[model samples]
Target: MAEASNGFFSAYVDSWDVLQIPRIGGFSGTVELPGSKSIANRALLLAALGTNPDRSCILKRLPDSDDVNVLRNILPALGVSVVAEEQGVRIQADHHRLSASSGEFYVENAGTAMRPLLAVLSALKGSYLIYGNEQMNRRPIGDLAKSLQSLGVEIEASEGGCPPVRVSSDGWKSQEATIQGRTSSQFVSAMLMAAPLSEKEFVLRLEDDPVSKPYIDLTITMMKDFGVQVLRKDYQEFIIPGNQRYLAPEQYEIEGDASAATYFLAAGALPGQGPVRVNGLGRSSIQGDQGFFRILESMGAMVKMGDKYLECSGGSELKALDLDMNAMPDAAMTLATLNLFADGKSSIRNVANLRVKESERIHGLKTELERTGASVEEGSDYLIIQPPSRMKSARFQTYLDHRMAMAFSLVSAGVSIEIEDPGCVRKTYPDYFLDFLKVAQK
Candidate 1:
């Protein structure tokens, strides 16, 4: 078996420094989070699409992470002028067209940048080469390629249906196509983002129910916010009138990241810990990952939520749960660790897509949990976790996945554990351990 492809994307954390987890009774405190990665990438691309030839658009409170940074660096290559500000970036795109006749882009492991850029670039007049890190190249792009081919664009994927993609375009001809969604919702979103620019009315039909369906909703909602309307039929189909254009607003403020909040929220819910309040996301949060707090509340955590904030306090005991997590795969990883503290076994289902992430998450969870003295069972689309009678100290391997590092960090509360390649969290939450330490200090 090969080592997983996810690891440090740039010079930030290449040393693979071993991080020792400090034993703590509990964690509770106020921690402000960075902006939403999903929204920031989408908004940045939309800003480019909607930019007038004469003016620039400002995006505030952008996420400071490697995935989002990929978009920032690549934008200028495509003729988008970017000015780094104190909080975010100022972008001005000239008619949303590439400055050069052809371009080469290295997106590293940022799927958000690669997938969407694939769709948008396919419609422009250019020859483009889009490649990523080994881990990203391993993630499938076939579905998106087939969908683009249906619309009369030329694209070629490697033998495994992965990246190192080559896209050549004069423009597209077809107005309608059907794409499957069993693998990733990003396939659907990529097409939607590029649909309005089609030469004719565009209609995209899904062959099956989309995994991570809520992300598609985020895409549609953000598209509307940029002044392009998509006619949707029950999440199965989308219709975009041809010749429509994205309208960039004067400035857009990004919301707090709900996925990144999972650690602190769970820390507050650890038995005997004080209440933890997270600002930036609340009842009004558009991110589907926010539903994670609801899962915590269901499992006996006391949660108080308002329009802009949420506080969670550990219950007398954490209860085991059996539930589907297809809509929130990233956040659901936290549940695997939380289940370790439950009195009985817990189950998670409808997450087959997790296998294709930065690591084989289901297998990784089973292997690492067993190392900590827990009984684990793996399924094609699910897992069942049986808590250990007493946690055993172990050195957990992060496998280059940020979520893996963060989820396993929770084990330190039960027993002091060591985490290998802990800096991998820089992919999303750069100061995750620092913030966790802050909460633990209280």
Candidate 2:
């Protein structure tokens, strides 16, 4: 009942009221999505790191979102010039010096920025401080910090393994950086990005099985796209040769956001809703979240996949499924809500990491699902849900998490539901509900 902290979104959520989601008989249209945030942010940082002496790197179809905005703003402060162009942004790095003026850099709840930058700034030559909003400061970064420290980087954490990280390094020294994968894969991705800039060849040894291999693969693939080769032996080890530099291409086009596409895909897969086609991410999408459609297919949805588009239809009688969704946590949240339409109980497993996300996702989903007249049971690493005999209208609280607001919107497919803090979608898809309405007409 009490507000979390005085962040920008927190203030905005205080004055917001419940948003009633539109209930439609079916959906039949194509939704054009913005670029992938995961890819966009990674490319932006890579462009900054790989920029030639005075030359520039260009990227097209960048996602215009809060997280991207935060990274765009932070780059310039670190001495990278970001020029807005016709279709994309041009990044100009200081060729003479890798370390620009470094001071306190604030990233508001962007795990992508905070994690990667921690490893990156540690590889630079200046004393830098990185901090984020109240929520981000509470998220774990110790695993990443310790790995960097083992590589001879001077860094400090505030209290726990959380952020407000301070980095003082001459440069990255060549050493075997061992990191655990049980946490977020962002840790591995962060070090991989910074490993190339180290003084000697770098070998990243994995301690445990990684959670999201696709994201790590995405990072490696993009690194290679920029002309750097990473020798990977399964997910256990990654070898990056030292003195390597990132080469910028003429331009790179970002793929559509697969995580964002799951909502519409789910809509189309629902019993009454169907034939929703989403453009952007396709069969060749490098993003792992694209696999979410396979889950839908397993649940009996008819899906069509193309080179650059995906369409879903049918599933008049949806069936429940038990799935391990650790690979696609964000998309899995949409599945959690979509389970409401299933005829029997459903189970989502291997998502204990969800507890440390924007909010306690597992607990939040159970609470909100029960509030909306569903029978739910929560566990340390999983959720079990039994669809209600009939649906009931309820106001679902989002707990200031964007995925919660977006995932819960699926409840409207079966019953009318009101979402609290609807503005929270601005964290990623600002026009989400508006876009949903466009394709949701029968």
Candidate 3:
């Protein structure tokens, strides 16, 4: 890839094999986040499903990240028209045209793209093949495939029950199915989004509590916004009336990415000179990662909230925490690194799902944190971190994971460090280092 400048940053992120982050005084500025990748892709699919000749869905502030782009690029194959505008994207589709379409799609490593796309594609009267990069192919999709198969959708996953999924269906043939949710909530969310496409009432029952449950709520909330209602009995069952279709809203604005906000928030909470504020998410935000601010507060960081913003400043002393982060696994990566600055050992539990994410997060965290002199204990579903007496400058590998790259950047608050494959952040936040430089005082 050719190096391109963002006008602000001197070099292109993609051209860098290793990028050095200097120890900084601290961050003390506001960062305006991009649209939430989770919301943007979900909204994109919903908008495409809901579009008609009478109404076109105009989405505002949709993010221009690799993940969202994957879905955007593939929409045309499904007979949906996606046009880029100055503000966001406009989507339109005819139900008859969409139902009759069929094609191959490559989703890269975006779970948001692959999971939901699988369910939606299966609900249409078409034959489709959906595959992704090597990393995404390693992520399991069997639970979702089995659930769809039970619904009478002919589907087959790879040998290991991973992706490169093939689906052939003339539309829904059954009304009720059971899905195992313990592996991933995306499976559950996928089924929920597709249920409305059935001609009869669809009843979805969960076999176990889903990991990252908040994301399911996000899907339900967005589904309602698109004018589809889902009745739920706790987390175990969802009843989505069939013979219903998504009704596109005139326009929907995506909120700032709360996951991306965690890095700057941690910078403010570190032993710094002053406060750092992140604009885009507040108490009213739908993202579960917004709860990360509460985690910062529990760690003794001074936090203030508004309806659309969160502010944080260093406290007298950072306190360690022993907490379950099942609902906010993405933010948990940031918390894991933040533990390095705490007063004592910290333990983040109930995040074994991290092992199957874009990278094997638990093992990766343990390995990299140890390189920085932190004593880390890795578990099947948890991580225990003991801050070293003295931080060590080390070269950290990102494992092609965006969160890993951003989380380890926090180490610069105490010691100069080098991060490998810095461009991996383009998966979500393309301009991460440039934005980091804005608030970062070297």
Report, for every candidate in turn, its global Cα lDDT versus the true structure: 0.85, 0.85, 0.89
Per-candidate alpha-carbon RMSD to the true structure: 4.3, 4.3, 2.2
Backbone clashes in each candidate structure, one number apiece?
Answer: 0, 0, 0
lDDT of 1 by residue, 1-442 (tens): 1222332111234546676654666677888878889999999999998886776788998877988889999988878888888756888887655565689999988888999999999977778899999899999999999988887788999878999999998777788889998898888999999887774688999999999989999999999989888899988989987778888887888988898888789877877665998888888888999999988888888999988788899988888989999999998789999899987999999999999888889899899999989999999999999999988999998888999999988888888777888788878778777677767751
Best by TM-score: 3
Which ten residues in a row are the worst by lDDT in model 2? 3-12
For candidate 3, the lDDT comes to 0.89
Q: lDDT of model 2 at residue 201?
A: 80
Backbone clash pairs for candidate 3 read none
Q: On residues 68-96, what C-alpha lDDT tens digit does candidate 2 reach at each position?
A: 88898988777788888996898878763
lDDT for model 1 comes to 0.85
Tell me the TM-score of model 1.
0.95
